[model samples]
Target: MPDSDKLAIAAHLHVLLRRKTGRVTDTEWMAVNADYAAEVVRFARQRAQEDGVPELADWADRLDHAMHAVAPPAARRPLLDVATQAVRQRAVPAAPEPVPEAPRYVGGIR
Candidate 1:
């Protein structure tokens, strides 16, 4: 998954934790800090079990997998090759289509 997606999930989990357990957390920090993320995950799981809220447990499981999963390395190519590919893609650009006109209100009876 992308870093942005991870950050979004972390933010959501942070809000859920705060609302359910009154524990405030830094979403940005959690995204980068594995230890803090782990602590939060454990707390969430424990709370889920105690409160019998399966939804919280599900979110915790997602976060656990996202944090632990290894991200694949980005593909790299020669600068010339990349430039040639870009030029080739741009060589046959499609023509832009005309935009549709918006409907106008006629005294609230359009």
Candidate 2:
């Protein structure tokens, strides 16, 4: 999955965890920190079992898998870097298309 998708999942899980367990977590950190993510996953799973909420367990499972699948920090590029490279590569900007003028009626009633 793409990094954006993974981050989205982490954000969603963060909100769910907060609402269900009153535990606040940094969504961005959770996306990159495997150890923190693992701890969150364990806590979520334990709460799921205790509260008998299968949905929470499923989310925790997803987080666990996603965290394990993430690339190492060194291998991952920051979004700012990608944007900067894109900006640098664009040598010229494209001209905007011209808009057509609408026809005007002369008579009050036709």
Candidate 3:
């Protein structure tokens, strides 16, 4: 890919990562964004190789350096798991319907 294309891809990846995950806690950073961070570095490296942007390679190096600060991905509960647990903890049983009363008879009726 051309240098410009690679740079654009890298920027887009970073923007999307930031938007989807927001600012992650230090413990959750890699679990949420490692793949995205790696993708940005991959594209940045490609950008550096294309024609004239040596700075792109520098960017890729910096990105790699930053990646080390993030926590490594670890086993974490999915959102569904958390939601299901919450529902179970507070579940309320459905109320039963009452039976209808029988019709009353009139003494004057034949």
Candidate 4:
């Protein structure tokens, strides 16, 4: 329960959010992520306090400012791919076995 731990929790929450929902299309995911980020701002302050910091809002803001400093598409493409794939793969059903049809008897008059 330290400042570092609080920051880690915030980072984890973001990653965890990203890793959910297979069919969450990129646009949908992005929108949802934006929402989560907004929510996390509030959560991060609470989390930092839970982790034993006073005035966690200030600490959370600093942590987030550093996090947001990372802003290159190339910087995040791999993470995005991993999260999307993990979700998509989990949602997909396994290939089903084909069932053979029973042989039909020809009419006796045939």
Query: How high is each candidate's TM-score?
Result: 0.63, 0.60, 0.34, 0.25
Candidate 4 per-residue C-alpha lDDT over 1-110 given as tens digits, one digit per residue, 9 for 90 to 100: 24454456455445433443111123223223545545555665565566554445564464456445545666556878899999999999999999999556666543
Better structure of 1 and 3 per TM-score: 1
Instruction: Look at candidate 2 and give me any clashing residue pairs.
Output: none
Tens digits of per-residue lDDT for model 2, 1-110: 56677688888888888888898988888888889888988998999899887778888889889877746689889999999999888956788999898657656555
lDDT by residue (tens digit), candidate 3, 3-109:
34444444544553344434222223422355765765676567557635566567556556655553345645689989999999779776889979865766757
Candidate 3 has its poorest 10 consecutive residues by lDDT at 23-32
State the TM-score for model 3: 0.34
Q: Relative to the true structure, how large is the alpha-carbon lDDT of every model?
A: 0.83, 0.83, 0.55, 0.51
| Ranked by TM-score, top first | 1, 2, 3, 4
Q: Which candidate is the best by lDDT?
A: 2
- Sort the predicted structures by lDDT, highest score first: 2, 1, 3, 4
Greater-lDDT candidate between 2 and 4? 2
Query: What is candidate 3's local distance difference test score?
Result: 0.55
Model 4 clashing residue pairs (backbone): none
**TM-score computed on alpha carbons, candidate 2:** 0.60
